[model samples]
Target: MGEPNKIKLGISIGDINGIGCEVALKTFLDNRMLDFCTPIFYASNKTISEQKKRLGLEISFQGIPSAEKAHPGKINVCNVWKENPRIQFGEATEEGGKFAIKSLRAAVNALKKNEIDVLVTAPINKNNIQAEDFKFPGHTDFLAKELGGDSLMFMVSDDLRVGLLTDHVAVKNVANEITTKRVKDKVFTMMNSLKVDFGIRKPKIALLGINPHSGDNGTIGEEDEKIMKPAIASMFDDGHQVYGPYSADSFFGSGNHKNFDAVIAAYHDQGLIPFKTLAFGKGVNFTAGLSKVRTSPDHGTAYEIAGKGMADASSFTEAVFLALKVFKNREEYAELSKNPLKKHQLKKKTKAQ
Candidate 1:
């Protein structure tokens, strides 16, 4: 079982055929990582042993029957399966998808039951992992259903946060997906997350335009004027520090993103392109506005360098640090929320005559 004080962190091993296991082992190889939390990997003992040998990593972990037997001050592997998995390094196979789901399901179940305080997921291939039981687009959608709440695809690197209006939707369907309700919900989710997760008092948000020059007054497109503008305006009138239908082309390049607490992009690539370019090898994909704390590395499964020992573990390591930091922040925030401080209006001093 987990120690009374050490936070139990459940790790979901994603895509056995890729670099998930490699990066995970690299992250935990440093003994300093165990000081923050008790790490529990939802994979079998044989699998971990194989990965260690393949990668030539010098580390040892205890094999536990389940998360209930996880111990602090030691790396724990919850052997979800008794048999050894067929690990084809650098290849995507159906077996890879199946066992990935096994690890994910076990970790998620532990997260749901409060057996784990936080969850740090490795990357998974979206194509092969599609099954009838898990028909969602990605982790955000699946976690939203299991954890219950509006999950925002929040990419975080220090103070730079970029949120998505629509995630995993086709380019042709992006415009139709941006409804007033969707905008409002996303804005609220982002706003609330800034306060609760990141500890911002009043969040200043920038909204990215859907078209060139923010529609150029309807010359290029009508989305900015017709849909995005009105929604941002309405939210601003509601006393939220929401601004723009700004041209996304110049926003990040001109360093305008650093001016706000967060930026809301119209779609997945719109936010991710700049975010990954700026924060690559260091960014963390954090799911905001969820009931539970879940985070993953910004990068995906590197099939090309799966077992070649060429994968970098910095992003995965950052994900671990972030999950633990957010867990403590949430606990403190919840306590403060119970008896929040009253908002007081300060009187303006009269000018001396």
Candidate 2:
């Protein structure tokens, strides 16, 4: 077992044919990571062994039947499935998606049972992963349903944090989905996440406009003025330090986003396009508002470079690091909130008087 203070990180191997296993194994290769958390990978030994051989990596993993048997100081692989599916690198097959769902479901169950402190999921093929058992658009949606909360797709890095208003929606339908209530809920979620998960006591959030030039006063579109502006006003009236339906075109160009603690964009591409451009290979996709902590790399399954031994593992490693950081921050924030020093401060002031 790891130290009492150490966290237990549960990992779900995404598409078996994707870079999920590659990145997971590569990230755990650094022995120093074990000092902070014990990792339990929800995958079979056969899958992990195949990937290790294909990548020609020297790392070793301990195969266990469940998270309960996971040992510290070693990478643990919990066998979610016994059958070994064909490893087709760079191919999106039904078998690969099936195993990905199996791994994810198993890890999510462990997370719900409190066996794992945090979850770091690898990328999954959104199309092939669809089944009657797993019908959600992506990880964020699936987690929101399973964990019973309105989750926000919050992307984070050292310098920037971006959250989406409407995730995994088509471009044509993005505007219709941007309702006053939706905007308000997303902003509230972002504000709470900034304080509780990131340790920001008072957060300033920026909201992006839904249209070109922010609708140019309705010449291009009116969603920015009609829906977005009112939502910003409502949040402000509620005492949140939120601002702007800023023009997406120049928000990042002028670097105004640096002034705020977080940004909320109207759609997936509106937010993620700039985020990936700024922190593509190192960004972490954090699902805020869930009862449990879950993070994943910002990028998707790289079918082109799945087994080339050239896939960059920076984003995946950063996801794990961010998960650990957020978990610690949440714990500290909880303790600080539970035993506030306001009473003590007042007593000290009385003594001085």
Candidate 3:
């Protein structure tokens, strides 16, 4: 009954037709993984077993009745559904969709009860999982609704941090959602998460323009000049180190983004296209503004090559590493906020004078 040495990780085994189960097992197979976390897949043992067989991977699976039974060096899975799911390598089915949803819900519930430190969700097929029985655009929207939190899908790689102003929205509708208030809120959320969650203080941020060449002073589009510019100006006055409505075309390569901590992308493709292009299979998708920390690989359920043993685990690893870092640093960040070093330096200087 002593305190468990392992941190319980609630992992949602995303779309079985894709690489979710594959990567989840592979990531857990690293024996050294026990040092950081003990994974509790919110999935049935059958689903994980089938995935391992299809991929021709040799790994052990242990069924645990509850989170308290979880142990390091073994996957402690809480079976979300009792029925055996019909899983095709690259095809979607009703049972598969339902199974994925069940697992996700279980993971979310575990997170709610404090049974897990953080939730590392694998990718899910949004279209397939949106049938009558299952619903959700993706994990971000689903978790946001479940946790009653405003979720911001932010993608991060080595040096790039991109937050979309509008995620999963139609291209035509993106412009309408880019209001000044919305922009300010997302910007502030990203800034706070950067400092508090990611240990980045004095976060320099860049705002992507809603137009070509940042509207060229109201020629291409007035949103940049009218909406984005004023929001950034207001934030600056409020003591934030933010800049731009920089032209999306050339801003990324100009080395300006490298100086800032994160960039707010106007829409899904606007930021993710460039981000994925540069950090594909390397970036981690994090849900900012959630009460609890959540992250996932910055890719989707690759149904085309599902069960082919071809899914890259780099993104998954990065996501796990990021979750651990964020969890551990939360306290450090709070301490830093309570006793800011910059304030102390200014105090010493004043005393000397």
Candidate 4:
């Protein structure tokens, strides 16, 4: 185990009944993980221990009172609550949601307070996690409010990067939500993320059509022609490498997404369907354009395979790696930006289109 600048990684145990803890815990069992960052899980030691014992895995971790006490090259469990919630492997209960929120809130507070350098969240059940206090659809919305930036749900892998125009919305409401401002906001957010987070100076961006055959040139639907095209053109004219309203039906199957650095989809499924198809078990959902860096596994809570030891930790592991990578990139970018000449030159080059 090696120390990585003593970077403290804050983790939120997503759903108590899910595979979040299993995969997250499995990822760190490899002592090599300590080479990259120190990790702190925002959950009770008892809760984590119960899951570990249920899965028959041995992990050495110390219980800490808060993120400030996290040790380098060691697993630190921040006890948000001392009492253990009921361990129903596949069942979603109010208790699960309550405790999950407890962990998430604690972790987010730690993140906002700068006690942790970055965050990699575990999977949470969307419906179960919904309540009066935590009424948002998912992490992106919650983080946007907490972190304060135009957020984009960026799905990333070695081969592809996809950002959504709108995520966690209804089909009917999606078209209504796809305004020019939103299209531009999410795309520009992705572009900036590509530059600053992924370290791509010149990133080519693509947009998939909201309608089949890209509205068949106004025959299929007007969203592609009316909404997406103008946004793409505006960004392009502003000196950004933005293009399309390409037919979504054939975009991925025809291998068109490989042509660009990133692709923007009209909605959640439009982006995630192809993304998951091509990179399931390997993709990481990065909440780009936020004040704090947060990433999660592409897949959600695997309730069915919660405790059989069948859950794959690949995506969760990638989330950790990505959170670290982005943190380093942002650090390097910030340092480079300190040079006024370099900063001015970069601004002139990109120019916020």
Question: What is the lDDT of every predicted structure here?
Answer: 0.89, 0.90, 0.83, 0.91
Per-residue lDDT of model 3, residues 1-353, tens digit only: 21366667779988888888888788867867767888889887877777788789988867886676786667778877677787887887766677778888888988988888899998887776786644667888887887765578899988889998999899898889889999988988898899778766578999889888888999997899889999999999999998998889887777677878999989898898889888998899999988888999988888898888988888998899888888877866666568879556645775676
Writing each residue's lDDT as its tens digit, candidate 4 over 1-353 gives 44546789999999989999999999999998987899999998899899999998899898999887777889999989978689898888888888888889999999999999999999888888888778999899999999999999999999999999889999989888989988888888998999999988889999998888999889987888888888889889999999898889999999999999999999899999999999999999999999989999999887888888999999999999999999999987898788778867766777765
**Where does model 1 exceed 4 Å of error?**
1-3, 341-353
Worst 10-residue lDDT window, candidate 3: 1-10
- lDDT pick, better of 1 and 4: 4
Quote each prediction's TM-score: 0.95, 0.95, 0.93, 0.95
The deviation in Å at residue 336 for candidate 1 is 1.0
The lDDT ranking, best first, is 4, 2, 1, 3
Error of 4 at 1 (Å): 6.9
The list of candidate 4 runs beyond 4 A from truth reads 1-4, 340-353
* Model 4: pairs clashing at backbone N, Cα or C within 3 Å: none
lDDT of 2 by residue, 1-353 (tens): 46744688999999989888998888888898888889999988988998899889999989998887888888999988889899999999999999999999999999999988999999999989999877888898899998978899999999999999999999999999989999999888888999889867679999999999889989998898899988899889989899998999999989999999999999988899899999999899999999999999987889999998888889999999999998998887777667669545644665676
